[model samples]
Target: MLRLASSFLSVPSSLPHLLALLLALLAPAASAMELGIDRLESRGFDSLKGKRVGLITNQTGVNSAGRRTREILAKAKGVNLAALFTPEHGLDGKELAGKYVANRKDPVTGVTAHSLYGPTRKPTPEMLKGLDVLIYDMQDIGVRSYTYVSTMARCMEAAGECGLEFMVLDRPNPLGGLRVEGPPVEPQWISFVGQLPVPYVHGMTCGELARMLNDRKWMSAQCKLTVVKMQGWERPMVWRDTGLPWVQTSPNIPRADSPAYYVATGIVGSLAGLETGVGGPNPFEICAGKGVNPDSFSNTIKNLGLDGVQVRPYTAGGFSGCRLVIDPKAKGDLCVLALALLVETNRASKPDLFAKSPADKLDIFWKVYGSTTIRDQLRQGTSVQKIAQAWKPGVEKFREERKPYLFY
Candidate 1:
């Protein structure tokens, strides 16, 4: 027994290597992706030493190993995690959009959980008491209209007001950092959804946005902000490429395919022009409603000669609508696909024939879009090519402006 123990202690590193090699040969290739939480845990939570942490996250905050961010924090070496804060969705992320989630106690950690989407959308001074740092870690769907961005901005403002050190555990944009689309929002039209004057698909991660927000002084005060960047990520890689797990960002936007098509479909859905499969199994993946002939619509979009994607008559769950099937591996510009559909749609579409959702439901898609120029251009029958050319300058300027804030 003494000799066996001695052999094990001496070959500790070799034994793990042999085991890993055997497992690698037996199983399929696993992703080598490392998320922000992965780096934080592996490197030891030195930055959080003796600090009472308050996390603003949800079910989406998980490492590549499927460990919850809150659980990782609760068990970290030096972490004094004191509170939990949830954004638009509740702690469990089951609450519907625009619904209020009240403050509750976390059964796992017993920490007080504050609902940022309840009566107030931002954290108040009372919520920050006794917490030394506020940590944010949630996967953003890569759209400006998503409430996560607004929640982050509001928290930044609160951190400034209450003198709290804030840090963000950066996640991949999921939409990647390239491919930006849509018109820059007008200042007056800005709201919680369009927190900043950015294009619809800003193509930025939450960490980059946090840095830009601080540098632009969008926050009330200049709070000490630290963004824990991802180690193995780059600008060109999307979520699927990263090999990280996907949690539904929202009820409608479930898998990666949903967000990839959301910005494009949102252009029509916001105007009450069409229904984009909200209550179905494939939400945000199908566009159908009154006046839509799937076969005709599919042929028209295909005739437009869009690259990297195709249109097809998609029928599922007793509904017949068209889906813009994007090849995940295709390197074509996704932003253009939506524009092509819109342009082709106007040629034969009666915008007046579009159906509208009930008022009680969360129906401010037009407000979420926040671009009168695009809407008016589409309404007046502008060519898709001409409309695409118009927004080139703004997108270029935004890309240049955000360069200094980019980490990966």
Candidate 2:
């Protein structure tokens, strides 16, 4: 077990080149990739055998074969599934965002399921009682401020405080692992949305982030940590490349490709008076606002020459703008695309979008964007290119700092 842990920690410095070569060699068998849950099951639940386990999961926590991890562990021969925990949207993934979910008995497993999104965000010592290990298994959209990763980090801290083992069942970052973008969270602005000090589009998986959090002492305490890594997943492979089924991560993120769109326009949506297709068919896929002409907006975005993205005029409800068609494989910074959209909206709208926005909304905007710098730059007429350049140092620093934590 010590040897296995050491091997997981010792990443070779030439990992990038080696990983590219490995991907080329394993192209044919890419579809045969096994998720962390699948690998854990195949190992006969060795790490969890005869242990009382608590699971932090939602609808996205499923094996590649479509079995829920909660159900799997409940019936595993020697594994005693003691408790269950739900994050933002609740266990069923149907609860509305930010709505409090109460603790209840899980209808399927009859386990006492706790709510991490309720009055208390972290599990208390009483909640950790009788549990030997806490396992985390949820699919994240690969963007910061999504809150699931925050819940994971808070849970890790709780587990550490309780001196319990914390295990992460690794999953692939749907946006791929090479596309790190946006600024790191500043110390003063860290909140539930931006818990970790990583980029807005930090491309590492939940397991990698967990390892970084543990090793860097980002958490209050260090727990005995283990990550059941996936088999055949590589850094360059996006969701489609993995051949895994897509489960709706949340209400807005209803598809595998939804994360890319989220990155493109989520920041813009945080401000007032713009609709990013929240209630429409294409959530987070369009940038629209009142009094804006769809053709002009679409043409403006198209003319930006942003790689990996195509734009078309789209009108929905009372708003009109462009529907973004994002190609995740191509070289493009989604964060820059968001900034451009904001700038264009400010120019097209009657009053400045940033100036007219309420203070609370602007606070949410800064929180999601990781700083007040971009908002200030936009209000002062700083171009998106200049803003990107200014934050480039922080993003580049994060890219280099994150190399050792990456598993693929």
The residue-by-residue lDDT of candidate 1 on 84-191, one tens digit each, is: 999987887788877899999998788889999989988888889899999999888888788898899889888988889999998988878876776666776677
Compose the digit string of candidate 2's lDDT tens values, residues 90-206.
998878767899998998899998999999999999999999999999999899989999999999999999999999999999999988888678888888889999988988999
* Runs with alpha carbons beyond 4 Å of true place in candidate 2: 1-30
lDDT to native, each model: 0.78, 0.89
Candidate 2 least-lDDT 10 residues = 5-14
TM-score of each: 0.87, 0.91
The prediction achieving the highest TM-score against the true structure is 2
Question: Root-mean-square deviation of each candidate, in angstroms?
Answer: 6.7, 10.2
For residue 370, give model 1's deviation from the true position in Å. Answer: 1.9
Alpha-carbon RMSD, candidate 1: 6.7
